[model samples]
Target: MIPIKIPREEKLEIIANIQNHFYREMSDEIGDLAAENLLDFMLKELSPHIYNQAIKDARTTVEQKMMALEEDLYALEKPIR
Candidate 1:
């Protein structure tokens, strides 16, 4: 599968969030590079599980919709005399 490409603006926002979280919550100061590195590591290690779960959710949704569609089609059939 092709690797996911984060938009530049969103990437910057995420990096900023990482830096802010470390500073505010952990009482640790980290630079932009450090924050960016952390974000990259998370994307590499954590994103796969999240991506898989999202795929599963989408598949379930589609399956339910398909079942509903089948039911509708069955409802539309005329009864034989």
Candidate 2:
């Protein structure tokens, strides 16, 4: 799998959030560079699992829609004389 590359703006936002959470919850001050490194590590470790789950979700949705379409097509069948 290709490495997941987050947009620069979004990455910055997430890093800021991580920094805030550390300060609020852990009472630890994390610098911007530390937060960015942490974000990079998390994305590398977690993105593949997240990507797989998203694909599974999309496949389920498509299967349900296909079933519904089949039912609708069956309802349109003409009765034999």
Over 13-65, each residue of candidate 1 has an lDDT whose tens digit, in order, gives: 99999988998999999999988888888888877888999999999999999
Model 1 has a clash total of 0
Worst 10 residues of 2 by lDDT: 1-10
What lDDT does model 2 reach? 0.95
Residues 51-71 of candidate 2 have per-residue lDDT tens digits of 999999999999999999999
Q: Which of the numbered candidates is closest to the native, going by highest lDDT?
A: 2
Question: What TM-score against the true fold does each predicted structure earn?
Answer: 0.92, 0.94
Q: Clash pairs of candidate 1?
A: none
What C-alpha lDDT do the candidate models reach, one value each? 0.90, 0.95
